[model samples]
Target: MPSQRGSARRRQRGVLLAGIAILLLALVLAAVLASALTRGKKEESLEPLRWQGRGTTRNLREIVLGRCYGYLAERRAELGDKDCLKIWESLKDAFIHKNPCNATTEDYQPLMKLASHPIPCNKSLFWSKTNDLVHLYTKSSRRFLTLEDTFLGYMFDGISWCGDPSAPGINYESCPKWSECEGNPGSVFWKMASKMFAEAACGVVQVMLNGSIETGAFRSSSIFGSVEILNLNPDKVSEVQIWLMHDIGGPQSESCSGYSIKKLKNILEERNFKITCEDNYRPVQLLQCVHNPDHPDCSLCTNSTEAP
Candidate 1:
């Protein structure tokens, strides 16, 4: 009778173990289903960054920067407006002479002599992916490349590229193709060009390691078309964007999806970019490339009735 009881207890224990195994399998399946359901809901909540042809594009861009990245457009945001002015004066003086690339020429020494950043590439900017874009996040059906996050990453990398007190640039290789790339002999030049890279002052610092960061001259004369600076630290932040006029076609060919896609792909893979361009030349759908330290002068953000 005792032997029979022992056998019976063993059978009961085996059944209990099997039951627990089945329950655990069911829970795993349920969890997976829940995850799938959550993902479906998120996809339904967001929209991609669309190229809303023309007038709305610039406005939308400005909105993205202002509402997305926390930066200001005013000249006052810059610490040394006077120094920039000094740099510009030096540039103007150098340009007065017929020979331009002779920055080493005594006539152009003033421009070459930079007390701070952009000595190699003055008035430059940086572009990079943000934390959210890199790691990505899901919320509802909406997909947002958060402006603040991405720009912060760019600025962080950019500052490091420029470095403190901003060193002078030593490398400015020819842009190769003489035809469309750098066509108009001496019309273009790199003020600050260096292959040596450093950690970003803004982002994860790992960003600048790729050598895609740059600090060169922007094509803007007026502050209206100038580059905007977005410094990221702990204390402050605000969203930002811009909306500029875009031709459905004609002028600014960089807007072509083919070109943009290629450029983006290059940036992603190699962290390298070559903006061998002239102002307002090729056909364009819209100007899509804009990010932290590498973008232009503007700033703003307002509450949206449309849900974020």
Candidate 2:
């Protein structure tokens, strides 16, 4: 009887041990499932925000088409052969039904090819940190042409667009800012367009820089410094002319002899290109003086005889 009772107790202990082992296994499975769910939730939360800065601009298609027609109407002599509809389709296909942040220069090749045109030699003007002044100078003087003055740049200027893998394709709810991602649609388009503009440039190319920028006028990271300057064909481009202009009210932080300007000159020279640097180029300065006529620096001429 004693042996039988001992055997029975051993059997009960084995069953209890088995139950504990099963309970441990179940707990481990539950822990793993909970961890996986937590990870999934974390990933979902980290996805990029769908709505950025006013979403894609409204009437994107109409705006693009209108600009295309307007460009053809104005520059018929130069770009009369371009197919507007095809151009639009190429532009749309670039980012449609795709991730907005995945934009690449290759995606814009079709549009570039379709819209390609020759920039007149010695007429290319590149600007860095000088948007308003550069455009103003280009418009008022008509001596040079910037990218925005071209057909491709004009059509998409100030427009925002992106795509979704879902229905309707376009993300009309919002679009990423240029700073949000390197592959931003607008940023990619402009980088390619700038590159093309630089590659096609011949003779002397002009660059306008803002001298008042404390961070230095010729930033290597800027489109002009990074894209346009690097893409310029040394054989085709004879020289690079740098125009360092400062605001009329003063705060002149950089000059032709400054570190940034010298850096730009060195890069051009290294690439076997001649370079010329000018400070407060008179023509552009005169334009700046238009609004600040009372500013002392606006008096570019000391005597009546010096007035042009």
Please, what are the lDDT tens digits per residue for candidate 1 over residues 110-198? 54343222111111123232223222221121222222232222222211110011112211212122233321112132212111111
**What are the per-residue Cα lDDT tens digits for candidate 2 across 8-118?**
999999999999999999999999999999989877754544845556778888899999999899888987598889998998899988888899989999999999899
Give me the runs in candidate 1 sitting further than 4 Å from their true place: 1-74, 81-85, 98-267, 271-308
Candidate 2 ranges with C-alpha deviation above 4 Å:
1-54, 305-308
Best by lDDT: 2
TM-score of each: 0.23, 0.81
Worst 10 residues of 2 by lDDT: 45-54
Top model by TM-score, which number? 2
Question: How many steric overlaps does candidate 2 have?
Answer: 1
The CA lDDT at 249 in model 1 is 28
The superposed Cα distance between candidate 2 and the true structure at residue 146, in angstroms, equals 0.4
Total residue pair clashes for candidate 1: 55
